[model samples]
Target: MTTQTLDGVTVNTQANVYFDGKCVSHGIALADGTKKSVGVILPSTLTFNTGAPEIMECVAGSCEYKLDGTDNWVKSTPGEKFSIPGNSKFDIRVTESYHYICHFA
Candidate 1:
């Protein structure tokens, strides 16, 4: 479904799942308290994990992310999945409107 936001941004949400399914843009699934989304032009900032491990799969486009703000920035693209460790902070910047599936486990 295409959910219309007050800001005029349109997002499609499908198959809300508790453990496994497709993700949406900035929508928090009630089944899991984690945030899952296909980000667009994600600004450079720190992503701090506060719970269990989260899974991110690069479906399209690319991203340059740095782990712990110390590790070098790495380029990730399609068919790649990165595990974000819990309690660690990572910085990310999207070169385009990349599609990603983030599973908060």
Candidate 2:
């Protein structure tokens, strides 16, 4: 199921803007020290590189992502998720606003 809320989280007020404001996110930390990010992607196509493995969970809307070394674009919607490896890159395409929570794995 999609995560609707997070309790007892310490949020960073600063926004992380990317792709010239096509994407924006806020970092959050749970009581257990688990870090995550909540964000939205506007209509655009962008490539992102990862320093750590991540699980991108879609809480609303949708996006199609193509992982490095692959040609297939997988669609992720509410309650769905995709994984990306560390040191790898992925291409994401969105036609509308896509809301997500990024989980580090």
lDDT (CA) for every model shown? 0.57, 0.96
Task: For candidate 2, give the lDDT of residue 14.
Answer: 100
Quote the lDDT for 9 in model 2.
99
Q: Looking at model 2, which ten-residue stretch has the lowest summed lDDT?
A: 96-105
In candidate 2, what are the lDDT values of residues 1-105, reduced to their tens digit?
Answer: 889998999999999999999999999999999999999999999999999999999999999999999999999999999999999999999997899999998
lDDT of residue 104 for candidate 1: 78
Write the residue-wise lDDT of candidate 1 on 1-105 in tens digits: 222222333334553332122222554444334455554444333344446677777777778777775768888787787777887766677656556666676
Clashes of each: 0, 0
Model 1 earns a TM-score of 0.56
